[model samples]
Target: MHRLKKSPKNARKTPHPKADIEAIGEGRRLAHLLRAKRKEITKAEQVRRILDTAHNAHEISLAENVIRSTMHPADQFEAFARLHHEEGMAAEDIAARFGVTAAVVKQHLKLGAISPKLMQAYRDEELTLEEPTAFAITDDHARQEQV
Candidate 1:
């Protein structure tokens, strides 16, 4: 068996009219330049920047803070509950998907149903995690606001 000769790294598949003048070597460099143009975003690094700037500058903060903090217990529960309640998913199905009990799903749904203002405050750390429980116990937004 005869071994085939390997092509040069800088060789172009198709011969261009300007190949001699411009050279196939530039093609490899151009390909590398194009690849280097891509933006690589590390989510952890992005979140760290957001968290570092959150207290100092509100304008530069991440709009989706809940998503950035992927492991926060309350965020997970609230997101699942929101999916179930707002998206019309069954609580049992949500429980099955999340590996939690139906009662837990119901509890999260109740918490997710709290007033948006209170929820935002909770997210911003202005209110304690448990503070929303009082509001969640009742269905009335007006009543929740009163308290």
Candidate 2:
């Protein structure tokens, strides 16, 4: 009788001993963990490359524009309203962009007209949110300052 030896590829994947099988599973798990670690290291290296690279003039300009567009909501809305009004855009059109009624846009424009001191006071948390609205009810800067 002749015995035929199994090639490495054709050999049984699991050992007959339970301990050997468990060790093989653990080794597979460790290999998977190492692969994940390697992927994370590659991602970190890519981030470092992006941060260390010198940006061109256009890239810098784009970054500046993005930063400028990140103004506080109140200030940003006021600026948008003011520019729209200055550009002869209809109140209704501007209101559509703001997703508010024309009346609300008009009221916001009124609030936008308030003195810078009052606006700064509102921004500084020194005055309640309603205080600015009350000031907007009257166009008198003297009265607004008094409040």
Candidate 3:
């Protein structure tokens, strides 16, 4: 069994093996699920071995928890729009590729149709995501911008 050396500052507070085992189990389960879906997740990609000496583990944990964020809705809409118009992909095809329902893809496409000015406002944080989503009711750029 591998043992994590306790930090000198907290010699009594060593990491629990049970927690590490559970984390590994969860990683294996995720790998299996992704593999079943034909996603290319190699075993190495599923579980990474981090040397305790290579970096500060606490810092890594903090970064993982704090630095990650979901893609902005406007950016998602633009990507879907590009795939639909520039790549000539149908909504259903884009949906399948992204593992989303066709309706969701259609909604994104509608959001993409919002006026560029409104989209810019959203990107600039001047408008909330819902504001642009509401503008999606009309495809006319001039009409959307007017609102």
lDDT of 1 by residue, 1-147 (tens): 268565653223223334243322334444555555654433233221112533433322333332222344456556776677577899899889879999988888888788877777876677887888878889788888789
Model 2 gets an lDDT of 0.60
Give the runs in model 2 whose Cα sits over 4 Å from its true position.
Answer: 1-73
TM-score of each model, paired residue for residue: 0.48, 0.47, 0.57
Task: After the best TM-score superposition of candidate 1, give how far the Cα of residue 145 lies from its true spot, in angstroms.
Answer: 1.6
Error of 2 at 25 (Å): 40
lDDT of 2 by residue, 27-75 (tens): 3445556766878444233221123245464655454445323334356
Q: Per-residue lDDT of 60-132 in model 3, one digit per residue for the tens?
A: 5565446534456777888888889888999999999999999999999999878888887987789998899
TM-score top scorer = 3
Model 3 lowest lDDT segment of ten: 10-19
Cα lDDT listed for each candidate: 0.62, 0.60, 0.72
Q: Deviation in angstroms for 27 in model 1?
A: 33
What is every candidate's alpha-carbon RMSD to the true fold?
A: 21.4, 27.0, 14.0
Better of 1 and 2 by TM-score: 1
